[model samples]
Target: MRFQWLLIIPFFCLLTACSSSQVHWRDISSNAVQASAAEEPLSLCRELYKDEAQIYQCEVEMSALLRARQQCEKDTDPSYCVLMAEYTWRHYKDHVLEDSPDIKQAGNYPVMCGYKENQITPCSLTK
Candidate 1:
């Protein structure tokens, strides 16, 4: 029984390590999302469309996600950064437009970090 307790201790420690890393990654991605959502083209787009009359939302979100992904890449693995960016972007978008039923539909983005249709546009992850 005492030896079992010793084994359980390592298991708990391993769990804690995994949990901490998850939390750290989450925090990094979330922070990047929030910050990118508020800066540059996003904010500019919002200001330009205070009435929300157009579908500029897709472009805005793509820009913000790209910015967030870049920030996450700077702080962690590139592939993981992509996942984190998409996850946090979805989270942020869901909360921001919680009442808008139409916002639930996914927009046209690229399948990866790079642009697909136009180089002048923002990167998307859903080509």
Candidate 2:
């Protein structure tokens, strides 16, 4: 009985060790922001990942956000457009930082998706 108890304890310990070790998004974003310079736009996302694919993704996302910011300046509803752009930036920032399990779910609002001309589209459901 004592030997069986010892084996069970080890098994539980091993299971605990194998559990997920994902870092929280806020901490990762905070660290990345601190590592970057104020003058550089891409630098804000550079520390989000180490692999080439992920780095490229960060660059792409940052570029799109920058474009959106520029467009917002010319938008009829500049304040609303700019606010949505900033929100989108934060959304993708969290996406790059979390690196956790899949966040998408059926019927869920598409938050990672982008807007168009200061308006969020796809209001109607699709198959």
Q: In candidate 1, what are the lDDT values of residues 1-127, reduced to their tens digit?
A: 8899999999999998855412123333344455466655344444433355432553445454555565444332456546745765566556755543232333332223332223322333222
The C-alpha local distance difference test score for the whole of candidate 1 amounts to: 0.46
Candidate 1 minimal-lDDT segment of 10 residues: 114-123
Q: How many residue pairs clash in all the candidates, one count each?
A: 3, 0
Best by lDDT: 2
Q: Which residue runs of candidate 1 sit more than 4 Å off their true CA positions?
A: 1-55, 96-127
Clashing pairs in 1: 110-124, 110-126, 110-127
Which RMSD values do the candidates have, in order?
A: 15.7, 11.2
Cα-based lDDT at residue 39, candidate 1: 50
- C-alpha lDDT values of all predictions: 0.46, 0.48
TM-score of 1: 0.31
